[model samples]
Target: MIDLNNIEEVIKEEKKILRNKSKNYKENFFEIKNFIEKEILHIETLKKNGINIIPEINFKDLSPSLIEFKKEVKNRGCVVIRDVFDDNLIHQMNKDLESYIDENNYYEDQKKKSDIDKYFSDLKSGKPQIFGLYWSKTQVNIRQSNELNHVKKWLNKLWVNKHNNQTIFDPNNELVYADRVRRREPGDTTLGLSPHCDAGSVERWIDKGYQSVYENIFADNFIEYNPFNASYRNETQEIESAAVSHVFRTFQGWVALTEQGPGDGTLQLIPIAKSMAFILTRALMDDVDDNDLCGSKPARALSVNSTYHSLLLRGLVSIPKMNPGDTVWWHPDVVHAVEDQHLGKGYSNVVYVGSTPYCDKNLAYAKKQSKKFLEGKSPPDFAAEDYEVNYKNRAEISDLTPLGKKQLTL
Candidate 1:
C-alpha cells in the first residue's frame, strides 16, 4: 500500500519518467490520476456491496447478501464471498470425482490429451487427478441447482444487466463459464498466471478503455462515477476464450470453497490498482528502447521476473489475504497474481469468476470462433496451437447472442 503521502513523490517521478519518455505526457498523466480516482470509487463500491480487499474488511464468519454480493462485485470490481454455495456440497463433489477416477480409472481424456513426459508420468508415475466436473452428471446437477443458480442469477445481474435483473435462466441466455472451478492445493505454486491486463494494451494515449478500473482517478466531478453501469456487461454465456477477445472483464473473481484464514493459502492483491498499473506500464516502457518494440525484458534496471520485486523503492503496494467462504474480487485492469500457498494445511480451492461482457464488436469475433470449433480447431482468439483441449462443448451461453460475448461468457 503506497501511502497517500508517497503518492506525491510517485507522481513526481511519474512526470520525470513521462517527460523522459515524454510523448503525450500531459494528456496521459492526468488520465493516470483519473484512473486512480475511478479505482478508489470502484473499491469503495465493492466494500459497500460486501467483499473488500481493503484493510477494513473483516472476513469473520459472516456471509454477505446475494444482492449485496452482486453490489460488491460491481463496486469493488472484484470480491471473495464466503459460502456462495454450501461448502459441504463442494466437499461431496470432490469426493465423487475422486471416486469416479478410482472406480473406472476414468483417465482416457488425460491419456489421449497428454503427451510424452505427461504420458510417461501418468502411465509410469501418475498425472494430476481431474474430476469430470465438465461432464459428470453430479457436477452438472450442482452447478445448475437452484441455490447455485441464484448465485448465477445474481452474477448475471451484477455481471450483465442490472436493469433486467433477471435472476432466472432465460433460455435465450445463461451464466457464462458456469463450469470453471479449481481446487488449488497448499503447496502448488505453478498454476502460471502472469500479471497482465486482459484487454491487451495499456497505451495511456489511446482510447477511453481503461488499463485499470481506477474510478477515483477517472470519475472527476461526477458526484458519483457509477461503477455498476450494468449496460456495459449485459450478456450470458458465450465465447470460446476470455483472453484476446478483449470483452469488458470488469471484475475478476472467485468463490471460496473452504475455510481460509491468514497464512492459509489465501488470495493476495496489489491494493492500489491504478498506481500499480501506472508504475508497471512506465516500468516496462522505461526499461525498453527503440529497437525492442516487442519490449522483452532485455537485462534492464527495472525487471521483475520474480513477482516480489518491489516496483517502487520508497513505497510498498498493500496486499490483503482472503479466507475460504471468503471471496476476493477485483477490477479487471487490476494486476493480480496468486500468492504461493506455502503455509496452509488443506488446500485453497476456488471457482474463478469474472464479469460477463457483451458488445457489438465482440459479437462478430465470436461467430468466427464457432466456425473454428466446428472445424475441431482452436478458437480464432487464441493461437493455432494454444489451449487445444478435448473438452466437449464451447458454445456461447448467449450471443449478446453473438459469438464473442457468447464464447467468453463461459
Candidate 2:
C-alpha cells in the first residue's frame, strides 16, 4: 500500500523528527524558566528572614557540596572548582596534543605564515582571522563535537543532581554549541580576547526566555532572592526572544585537562555574578560609583554594581594556579580573561561549553555553523587559527578516523 521509493514518504517520515524537535524546544526553554523563577523566590525568603546564603563546595561528597556551591554561585552569580577532571586522562591528552603541534611545526605564529602581526592585527579591527595551527588529530577527536555530547551530558547531569535530582535539560533535546580549543605555549599572547559580553548581552535586551534567569532582579523587591525555586527555568514571560530555533547558551564552560599554573595560563573569574550583571546592565545609566548598586556587598569587601566593580573585577580575576584534571566554570555575566602563558613551558587546554538558550536567533547561528563545520570553517565568534590545520586540509581529516569522523563528515 506504501510507495517505498517515494520522496513524499521520506518527507512524511521527517515530519516526525520535526515534531520531536519542537518538544525539545519547549523543554529547553522551560528548563531555564523554571530554574530562575524558583531560585529568585527562594532567595527572597532568605532575605525576609535575615539569613546568609553562601555555601562552600568541597570534593569529598559532590552532591551536597555542589548544591551549596551552586547557591553561592547564584548569589555571587558564578563559581569555579579546581580538579574536576581525571589527571591521568589529561596527561595523556596533553601528551598527544603536544606531539601533534610539534610534529606539524605549527606554532601560534605559523597560521599567520609566521606573520604574527599580519594575522593578529586583524583581531583588533574586529575581524575574524586565526593564523595559528588549527588541525590536530587530538583536537578533532577529543576537543570538537566528538566530545561535545559526552561533556554536555556530564554537565547536564551535574545540573540535575545539583538541583535535587530534577532532570534539567533533556540530553536528547536539540542544543547548539559555540566552542573552541587551543594550545597556548609559553608567552602566547596571541589568543587575547578583550573584555566583552558574549553575543553583546543579547539575553538581557531581547531574549525574554533568558531574561527569566534574572527575573528576581527585575522584581521591585530585592529581598526576595530565592535560592531553590524551579520557576527560573519554566515560567513564561513576555519577550521578543529570538525564535530562530537555536540555542545563546545558558552556560559557558571548559575542561582544563592540563596542569597549567598561575603564569601558565590557567583561568580567572570575577566572583560576583548578580552585581556584575546589574552593573553591566546599568553601565550607561550613570558615571556614579557602582559600589552603591546591589543589595549589600558580601562579607568580602566588594562593590554591588558599578565601574568601581571593574577595579575589583581586576583583583578577583585571578588564575588559581591549577593542576592537571581541573575543570573551571564561570558565568557569562562576569568578566573573564586568560593570563598569557609566560612560564617556560605550560598549557591551558580546554573544551568550551555554554548556556545557550534554545531559540530562533541561535538557530540561525547554528545553521551557519553547520555549514562551517562541513567546509572546515570556524564557527561564528570562534577565534581563528585555533584549528587552522583542520581548515586548510579537510581532505586529510576526511580520511583519518578522528572521533566521530563519519558523523561529522556527513
Candidate 3:
C-alpha cells in the first residue's frame, strides 16, 4: 500500500539534507574513525580476557544510589538484570509452558509454528520449536506477573526526558506489548536475525517525528545526542505493517525461561553509545550513493556489520550467562542480533517483554491490543493471524492481574 514514488522523493530530499551537511559530516568522520580504532582495541582486550561488556545487576539491588551502574547501562545501551523473578517462579513458569505445549499437542500442530523454521529448516527437528501462539496461560501469567510489571516500570525509569521539563508520559506507568515466545531446541539456529536496530528502519530518517531521535547526528552534533532522551518518540508513528513497531520501547527486554550463555543461543549486542553516532555519520559520508538512505527502507531490517559498520561488528559481544529467573534489556536503538547457533544441550526459551511508558501513542496501541486479546487475535502491529483462537486452556480476562487489567484496560 506504500507509494514507492513518494518514498523515492523523500529519499532524495533526505540525501540533499545530508549533502548540504557534508562539510561537517566529513570533519566528524575522522574523529569517529580514530575513536573506533581505540575502541576496537579495548573491546578486543576485554574479549581476550573473557570479560563481557554487557552490564549485569540484580533486580532487588537496583536503586538511584547506584550512579555508576546506571551510567554504564546508559552508555552500553543494554543490561542484564538477574533475579527479576524468583527461581521458583521461573521454574514453574517454564513447566507451565512445557505442559501447555504438551497438553495442546503443540509440537505436532503445524499451525503453531513460526517462520523461523523455514529460514533454518536444515537445522530444525521434526518438532516445531518457536511458537506463535500468544495468550497461552503461561504467557499471560508471566505478562501479568507483579515482578515482571515492576521490572518494566524500573526499566522505563532509565530514560530521562530532556525537552524543556515538559513531561509527556509517566515512566511509573507501563504498557504491555503483546509479543511471541522463542523456545529454541538444542543446536537450533532458526533465528538468524542479523545485527539490526529495532523499532524504526527507514522511518528513522524519513518520518519527522522518528527522525528527531537522531537529529543530533544528522546535524553533525553527534556528541550531544543522548539515546536515553525520550523526545518525539511517543509522537512518532509507523505505517501499519507487520514489520513496523507499533510502540516505542525504551528498553526491549525478555524474561529467560531457561539458562543460556555465550555460544548457547544468547543475544549479541554492540555495546557502545558512540557506535550509534558513528553509524549515522558514516551513512552520510560523501562516498554513499544518493539512491540509498544508508540501505534503509520501510519494513526492511537495517543491518549494521562489517559491510556498513565494521567497527561495530568487531565490538559485538554476548552477555554473561543467564539463568531462568534473569531478565535482559537493551535500548531500542541498540544494535543487536541472536547467536547464529545454539550449542547448548537444552531448549533456550524466553518471552519478549519491553518497557513502554504510558503515552498517547502507546496507550492507543494498548487499547487495540486489549481488544485483540479478548478476540483471540494478534496485536495491531502484528499480522492479524487467528492461530490461537480455538486453543485449549488459553488465558482469559479473569487471568489478568490487577496491573495487567489496568494496562489492558479490562
Candidate 4:
C-alpha cells in the first residue's frame, strides 16, 4: 500500500517504476509531443473555418445516427445533446427548485455557515455558484426521468466495456450519482474555474489501477492509448477527499435549466479527445521534478494551467449557447472550465448529472447513497451538509417513480 503521509516518497518510487516500464521515456515523450502538435493544428483549422469544436446533436436524431454520433464524441471528447427533455417540464422543474430554496430559507442558512467544502474556494463569485442542496423534488424527478436515463445509457455505451470476454460494466442500466446544482445570477462576476480534470489528481500517476488504464501511454505507445477503454477505470481508487467522486462516471454532465451561451459563464473545454496522453507523457519528461506530477496533489482536482499545459490550452473553446432542457457531456479526462463572468440578463442554472453506469464500484456507492437519500442527507461523495433533512417538499420514497427507485437502488 502507498503511504499518503509520505507522498513525496511515494511519488519518487512511482516515477521510477513507470520509467522502468517505459524503458525509453525520451522517445515516448517525443511521440506524444508530435501527436499533440498535430491535434492543435487541427483544432486551429476548425476554428478558422468558424466551426464550433464541441459537437452538438439533437436527441431526436440520436437513434438513427448513433454510429456517427459516437465517432464525433470520441474525436472531440465532449458534446451537447439538444432537446433531451421537454422544455415545459424543465421550466417547471426550475420553478419548483426556486420555490424549494425560498421556502427553506436556503440563502439565509448558507450565509450563517462557514465554507464546509473547499473544492471551489479558489473561485471568486458574488455568491455561491454551487449549492449543496440535493434531494429536492425537482432534482429527484429529473434523475428518474426516462428520457434522461435513456440518454445516460447511450453515453455509457461510448466506452468499451468488454475485454478478454469479461464485461466490465453494464451500459444499459444507468445509476444515480446524486450531485449538487449551480445557479449563477445575471451580471455574475465570478473568476470561474480554471482548467482541470476531476475524479482523481496524483492518483492517476501513482495508483496501480490508473497505471493499468494508461499502460499504453506508459509503454511508449501513446498513439494507441484509447481513453474510452474501460479496462481498469472502475478499479482505480482516489485518496479520500470530499472533492473526489467515488463512483465511476463514464461522462460528467449537466442538464441546463435556463438559456445561456458563451460569455454567460458557460463551459469551455480543450476539445481534443486524445490529449490525455500528452498530459501523462509531459509529467514523465526530464523537466518535471521526480517528486511532482505537474502540480497534482492528493484530495484536489487535477489542474491544467498555462505554466505546464500551454499547448493543450491552445484548443480551449467555449460551448455554444444552450437552451433549457439541453445537456452537455464530457469525457472524464477532458480538461474543462467555466467562463469568468455571466454577461447575460438571466440566471444560468443547471442540475448536475453524470453518466454513471451499473458496475460493482458504482453499485456500492449507490447503496450508500440510497440511505442518505432516505434520510435527506448529502450523498456519500459530497460534504455532509444535510441541507434538505427537514426542508419542505423534499422528495420522499412515495415521490419516486419505479425507474427512480431502481436508479437510486432504493
Candidate 5:
C-alpha cells in the first residue's frame, strides 16, 4: 500500500520508474518541446487573425455524424452549446436557488464560520462564489433535465470508448456526478481560479493506470497520443482527498443560468486538445527536480503556470458570451481558469455538470453519490459540509425523474 504521509518519497520513486521505462527519454523530451513551440506559434497566428478559438454550436445544430463539427471539437478541446435548456426553466432555477439559500440562512450560517473549506481556501471573494449546498431542488432538476442529458450523451460519443477490442465505457449511458453551483455576484472581484486541470494532480504521473493512459507520450511517441481515447482512464485512481474526484469525467461542464460573457467571471481555457503531451513531457526535463511534477501536489488540481508552461499558457482564451440556458464543456485534460473580475452587471450563475459515462469507476461513484443525495449531504468526492441535511426544501428521491434515478444508479 502507498503511504499518503510520505508523498515526497513516492514522487521520487515514481519519477525514477517512469524515466527507466522510457527509451531515448532525452530525445523524446526535445521532440515534445519542438512540437509545443510550433503549436504556440500556430495559436499566436490564430490570435493575430482575430479568430474565436472556442467553437460555438447551437443545440439544434448538434449531431453525432457531423464530421466537421466533430473535428473542430477535437481540435479545440472545448465548445459552447447554445440553448440547451429552456429559458423559463433556467430563470426559475436561478430564483429557486436564491430562495433555497436565503430561506435556509445559508449565508448567515456561513458568516459565523472562521474559514471556508480547505479545498477553496485559496480563493478570494467578498462572498462565496461556490456554494457547498448540493441537494437543492434547482440542482436536482437541472441534473436530470432531458436537454442536459441529451447534450451529455452527444459529448460522450466524441470519445473513443473502446480499446484493444474491449469496451471501456458506454457513452450512451451516463451517471450522475454531483458537483457544486456557482453564483458570482455583479462586480465580484474574486481572485478567480488559476489555470489547472481537475480529476487528479500528481496521480497523473505516479498512478499506474494513468501511465498506461499516456503510454505513447511516455514512450517518446507523443505524436501518437490521442487525447480522445478513453482506454485506461476508468482504471485510474486518484489520492483520496476532498479536492480529488474518484471517478473519471470525459468532460467537465457547466450550464450558464445567467448571461455570462468574457468579463463576467467566466471560464477561460487553453484550447489545444493535445496539450497534455506538453505537460507530461515538460516535467521530465533535467531542470525540474526529481521529486517535483511541475507544481503538482497530492490534494490539489494539476496546475499549469507561466513558470513551467508558458507556451501552453499563451493559448489561453476566454469563452465567448454565453446566454442563459447555454452550456460549456471541455476535455478533462484541458487547462481552464476563471476570469478574475466580474465587470458585467448581472450575476454569473452556473451549475456544474460533467459528462461521466457508464463505467465501473463512475457507476461506483454514482452509487455513493446517490446515497448522499438521499441524505441531503455533500457528495463523497467533496468536503462534507452537509449544509442541506437540515435545510428545508431539499430535493428528495421522489423529486427525481426516471432518468435521474437511472443516472444516479438508483
Candidate 6:
C-alpha cells in the first residue's frame, strides 16, 4: 500500500503531467472543484429520492428513440433491463443450479475445502450463499444463448467512440467472460464486498493505458468525460496487482434467477458517473490531500466511504425490485456493493454475465478463456483451483452455440 501521507505529492506529480499536456489545465482544475461541489448536492438529492433516478427499461424496447432512457443510462452508468429472459427460463436455470449444487454436494465440498478464498474473506456465520462454480450448464447455456447474444450486442451499441468518431470494436460480435453465481439466501450476508468499483483501481492514474480513459478529466472538461468512449480502454492491460480483472468488461451484469427487492441483499450503486471527477479533484478541498486513492499499489477495490466521499457513501442506493429473468448491468466505473444484510424472504439468485466487446486485449482474454474451458479449468483471471474438472455435468465446448464458439475463439 502507498503511504497515505505521500498522496499530496502523488497528486502534485500527476497534476504536473496534466499541466504539461493541456494549456488550460489549471483553469480546469478550479472549474472541476466547483463542479464537484455541485455534483455533491445533485448526487445527494438523487440518493434522498432513492433509486428513482436509476432507469429501468425493457430489453426488447431498447432503441435510439428512447432518448430519455439512453440519457439516463449515459448519465447514471447503470440500468435495469427487465425481461431479458422469460420467467420460465429463469426458474429453470435456478432449478438447474440447485440440481448441480445438490449433486456435487456444493455446501459440503465448500466447507471441506480450505482454498475457496478467491472471492470472499470470512464467510458470515451461517451457510455459504455464493458458489464459485463458473462452468455450470445453466451458466454456459445463458452465455451462449442467442437471446443473450442479441442483448449484449444492444448493450455494446449503447457506447459510442466520441473521440475522433473512430469505431474501435464490433459491438455486434459478442464475447464471453464466465463469472460466479450468487445465491444470497434470506438473512444471509456472507459476501463482504464494500462500496467500490472493480475495474482498474489506482491503475486509473498509474497505468498510462488506463489513465487515457480519464484524459478529459485531467483536461478539466470532466463534465464531458464520457464513460462510453473506447479510447484507452481497448489497450489497458492489467499490471501485477491484487484483485485484477483481465478482461475490459464494458458493463458488469447479472441475470437474476429469483425475484429480489431492495432489502433482499440486492445490488447497490451510486448512479452518477460524473461524480468520479470529484474522486481525483478532492485534494483541492480536503485537509488530507484527498489521500488514499483507495486503489493504490497492491491494487484493491476502489472504495467509497464517508471519510473520503460522504456524499457518495450516502448516495449509494439499492436498485429497484426485480423479478426472475431481469438483468441488471452497471458501468465499469460505477461504485457498487452488495447489501450487508438480506432482510427478505427467499434466496436472491443471479449469474454474473458481463459484456466483453471485441477488442485486441479482450479477444486475447477470450482465446485464453476458451483454452481453459477446454481443459475444464478455471479461467486465467480466477483462482487456478478446478473443483469442477471432475464433475460429470460440466458444460463443454460442444455445448456452445456457433456464435458462442466464435466469441470464445474456438
Best by TM-score: 4
| Residue 402 local lDDT, model 5 | 98
Runs of candidate 1 exceeding 4 Å displacement:
1-76, 99-174, 178-180, 192-194, 199-246, 261-266, 273-326, 357-410
Residue 276 CA error for candidate 6 (Å)? 2.2
RMSD of each: 10.9, 13.6, 3.2, 1.7, 1.8, 3.8
Per residue, candidate 5 scores C-alpha lDDT tens digits across 88-177 of: 989998999999999999987666542645664432332344788778888888889888888989999999999889999999898988
Q: Each model's TM-score, in the order given?
A: 0.53, 0.56, 0.91, 0.96, 0.96, 0.88
RMSD of 5: 1.8
Q: How well does candidate 1 score on lDDT at residue 166? A: 46
Instruction: Looking at model 4, report the run of 10 residues with the lowest lDDT sum.
Output: 120-129
Estimate the lDDT of model 4: 0.86
lDDT, residue 133, candidate 1: 33
Which candidate tops lDDT? Answer: 4
lDDT agreement of model 5 with the native:
0.85
Report the error of model 2 at residue 408, Å.
7.0
Worst 10 residues of 3 by lDDT: 118-127
- What overall lDDT goes with each candidate model? 0.40, 0.43, 0.75, 0.86, 0.85, 0.74
- Model 3, residue 53: distance off in Å is 1.0
- Which tens-of-lDDT digit does each residue in 263-322 have in candidate 2? 675455545454333332332123333222222211111222233333333333444545
lDDT for position 396 in model 6: 88
- Tens digits of per-residue lDDT, candidate 3, 106-195, equal 666645444522322222122234566678877787777888777777777778754777886788887888787888778886654567
Q: Over all chains combined, what TM-score does candidate 5 have?
A: 0.96
| Quality of model 1 by C-alpha lDDT | 0.40
Q: Give one digit per residue, the lDDT tens place, for model 1 in 200-265.
A: 332221222321232223323222334444342323221233223334444566655555555554
In what order do the candidates fall by lDDT, top score first?
4, 5, 3, 6, 2, 1
Q: Could you tell me the TM-score of candidate 2?
A: 0.56
lDDT tens digits by residue: candidate 4, 317-351: 88889999999999999998888788989998999
